[model samples]
Target: MTFLAISGSARRASTTTALLRALQSAATPAHTITVFDRVGELPIFSPDRELPSPPDSVAELANAIADADGLIVASPEYIRAIPGGLKNAIDWLLSCDALIDTPIVLAHASHRGDDMLGQLRLVLGTVSTRFNEAMFLRVPLMKKTPEEIARLLSKDASQTELLDFLTRFAAYCGSAD
Candidate 1:
């Protein structure tokens, strides 16, 4: 299975991105996880641009989403809400058919982003019928450097948890009913 993991943080060294990257390494031979950390590169969405075609960045992201078997979104809380960039990326996809039936889940890098998580769940559920509200992975990597996070996630216990999460999500994606 191929999964697209999107990092909501645009920081040069986001712990969320590190967590997703670690998941990439922990994936088994039967699965592949690709991290998409360029939400910041997408221009703010507008209804007017949806006519002829969206911008190249928006098209690229939509294409990736269309190609992936599933999506895993990880985001940081910003003022108790979803970060603007991640929300913008979703907005850019609202009219696109890529997300309508895609299997999606959430991975949380911080233990403190429940507020953002709630909002993200609501938004994603609205956009995709296959959004799995039940399957989630939350690791408390907040305030840690990306390097530290990478090392921590490399530990045996963390690897086990990540692999289990990926396996469950992949099964969910492949299930017929």
Candidate 2:
């Protein structure tokens, strides 16, 4: 199975990105996790620009999501809400067929982002009918370096829990098809 992992933060060393990297490294041989690192490169979404010929970056994002079996999104709350870049990227997918029934997993890398998570749930719920609210993952990773976070996730217990959750999600995605 193939899962597209998108980090909603634009920072070079974001914890959200780090966690996705760890997920990529920890995935089993049967599964492939590909991280999308160019949310920042996507243009602000506009309906006028979405048809006929979208930007290369937007087309690429849509194609990636269309090809993946499931999606894993990790976002860091900004000012108590989802970041603008991530929101923009999602907006670009509003008209894409791929977003209609794809399975989605949301992860937050902050201790307290319930407000943003709630909003994300609402947004994703509209985009995909199969968005699994139960598969959400949250880890308080503020102030930690990527290396440090990776080390913690590498521990047996943490790795096991994450892999278990992903395995279940993959199974769910498979059955949903």
Candidate 3:
């Protein structure tokens, strides 16, 4: 399965982005995980601007999502809520057919951010029929450097967990098809 792992952080050195990158590295050859860490590049969504067609960057994101078998989203909590950039990306996809039936799951990078997670669950569930609320992976890698995250996730135990999670999610996505 090809999964688009989206990072919801705008910061260059974000733990959320690092976590997605780690997942991308851990994925097996059969399961291609593409990490999209550029939500910050998408233009602010506007309904009027979407009529003629959305921006090039937004279209590129939509195309990537369309090509993927499933989506894995990781984000950081901001002000006890979803980050604006991530939400804006979702808004751009709201009217696009690519997201309506796409399978989606959440992978949290922090031990905290339950608030943001809850809201993401609600939003994603609303947007996509195949959003798997029951399938989740939460690794406590907050405040860790990218090097530290890579080292930690490269361990045998962490690799097992990541592979297991991907296997189950792949099955779930297959079932939907």
TM-score of each prediction: 0.98, 0.96, 0.97
**Which window of 10 residues has the lowest lDDT sum in candidate 2?**
92-101
lDDT of 3 at 44: 88
Ranking by lDDT: 1, 3, 2
In angstroms, the error of model 1 at 15 is 0.6
Better of 1 and 3 by lDDT: 1
* Clashes within 3 Å, all models in order: 0, 0, 0
Native-referenced Cα lDDT, model 1: 0.93
Which scores higher on TM-score, 1 or 3?
A: 1
Error of 3 at 95 (Å): 2.0
In candidate 2, what are the lDDT values of residues 1-177, reduced to their tens digit?
999999998899888888888788888999999999779999888889967978888888899999999999888888989899999999888766658888998977779878889989999999999998988777678889877897888899878877887898899899944
Root-mean-square deviation of every model: 0.8, 1.2, 1.0
Question: Candidate 3 on 77-117: residue-level lDDT in tens?
Answer: 99999999999999999966668999999999999999999
lDDT of 1 by residue, 1-177 (tens): 999999999998898998899999999999999999999999988898887998989899999999999999999999999999999999998866778899999999997988999999999999999999999999999999867887889899999999999999999999963
**Which stretches in model 1 have alpha-carbon errors above 4 Å?**
none
Most accurate candidate by TM-score: 1
The CA lDDT of each predicted structure is 0.93, 0.87, 0.91
TM-score of 2: 0.96
After superposing candidate 2 on the true structure, give the runs of residues whose Cα lies further than 4 Å from its correct spot. none
Measured with C-alpha atoms, the lDDT of residue 7 in candidate 2 is 94
Q: Itemize residue pairs with steric clashes in candidate 1.
A: none
